[model samples]
Target chain A: DAGITQSPRYKITETGRQVTLMCHQTWSHSYMFWYRQDLGHGLRLIYYSAAADITDKGEVPDGYVVSRSKTENFPLTLESATRSQTSVYFCASSKGVPETGTRGYEQYFGPGTRLTVT
Target chain B: AQSVSQHNHHVILSEAASLELGCNYSYGGTVNLFWYVQYPGQHLQLLLKYFSGDPLVKGIKGFEAEFIKSKFSFNLRKPSVQWSDTAEYFCAVNPYGGSQGNLIFGKGTKLSVKP
Candidate 1:
């Protein structure tokens, strides 16, 4: 109950509609990410936030927008959903990358949101 | 461009059988490698990771992986697997000095262990 979570676990929308997938983590991690899992493509990073008010593009960020107004919340928005945008979206958070002479950190993932665009 | 490769797309095994999944990456310089498992209808969980220490790292659920830097490989192995081990396995890599949250993942291998 204290881990990361995603809202609207399953969603259906028409093309050109707008959809937002919400992610929240109680860990107060400094790094949060959004990834879309697709067949034959695996999981592609779409966006990530280093901390509140700091967001950046990932491998696949053409049609997706993300904002992290709060450290615990990172929401992804599809300005105009397309059929190509329909996929399983996952949110993850991590403390920080291991600095020199420090141990590494692993990410915690959410349940995932399965989005379908018709 | 950096990328991760998982050799198998699907693997079938019987209970108590030995298992190994191959993973490779195409990134120059130092890297962090990880193996993650996803059970049915579940989120991804870290199985093991290799950072800067020993090449052979043991993870949860009797899983272990060896990072062979010369070959750019990290292969997961389990001496004897159970039916409960049936799930999807993913390999990921992050280049050193890159963004902390930038991880390139493999397509994933689905393991089906028959009871």
Candidate 2:
């Protein structure tokens, strides 16, 4: 009730079909992020939004698109899904990287959306 | 580009045994270090973090990590581990701000505790 939640926890879609993963946070954090977790690669950032409309690309953003229309929600879309896009995707949020001189900022993570492409 | 490194890919330990997982980073200037844990089928949770003042930081569930600036290492440790302590741990780093907060994560270490 107090943390971030992701929708379509498990999804099965066909290749070339469009899909969207939803993330919503109750914290109303200024920053929201999307990451995909694969077997060998721990977690790779997809896209992140600093605020409502300021979104930036992250590593491995080739086949994904993101839009942040509101502060609480950041949704990631697969315009035309591919077999390679099947992975467990996670969403995260944090205030900032611990002021400026700090070595830490803790981020809250969502349960993650596991997508399977057929 | 900044990158995080986790040397131990998998570890198995008996109950009541001590535990340590290795983590390293390749970044110049300052550093922000973190250790995150993911129990089977659960989301990643923060174990602890090291900011500035102290190198040794304690986290929930009886875990601690020491940040060594010289070797670029932040290793997680537990004096005595329980069976429930089995999980996948990840080390992450973000070099600085003004840059998009892209977290560089290691390959991860999987710890299996035999009860």
Candidate 3:
């Protein structure tokens, strides 16, 4: 009840349709991230938000859009769902703390959302 | 570009057998290493993390990892594994000098401990 949670644990959508995955965290962490886990590619960051209304793209952000309307919520929207976009999505949040010269962002992950596109 | 390489994709062993999972990263700057375990039907949980002071870090469930700079490797080890230890293990690195806190994860090693 106190960790990050994702809605629609299982999703099925058609190609060309728009779908958004919801992510919520009880910990008011400073950073929230969206990652897509495929078979061979591991977990690739799609988008990350530093704070409310401040979002940035990551390694794979081609068809994905993310927004952080509140400190506890970061939603990832697929503009146009495609077969290639099908993957298990994991939402993670981390509180930014600078210990050394580098800012340490230890992430806490959600249960993950499995989406299938046909 | 920072990248993580995990040589083993799948590994199987009997109960009470020792385990070691290899992980290598390509980066010239300072780095922070981590090992995460995802049990069946569970979320990813931090097994251990390495910062600056200690290179040999111990984690929960009798898991530990050692960081070697010369080889740029951090290998996870356990004296013995249990059937409950069967899960996907991921090695991740965050470049300490970079602003992107995002982690570069390996393809992951799925370890199966046969009971």
* Candidate achieving the largest lDDT: 1
Name model 1 segments beyond 4 Å from true: A98-102
Q: Go through the candidates in order and give each one's C-alpha lDDT.
A: 0.92, 0.90, 0.90
Q: After superposition, how far is residue B3 of candidate 3 from its true place, in Å?
A: 0.4
lDDT of 1 by residue, B1-115 (tens): 8889999999999999999999999987788899999998888999988988899999999999999999999999999999999999999987776764577899999999999
| Residue lDDT tens for model 2, A19-102 | 999999998888889999999899999998889999999989999999998999999999999999999999999876544655
Per-model TM against the reference: 0.96, 0.96, 0.96
- Of the pair 1 and 3, which is ahead by lDDT? 1
lDDT of 2 by residue, B1-90 (tens): 678889999999999999999998998768778899999999999899877788999999999999999999999999999999999999
Model 3: per-residue Cα lDDT at residue B16: 100
Q: What tens digits encode model 1's per-residue C-alpha lDDT throughout A79-108? A: 999999999999999997655466667888
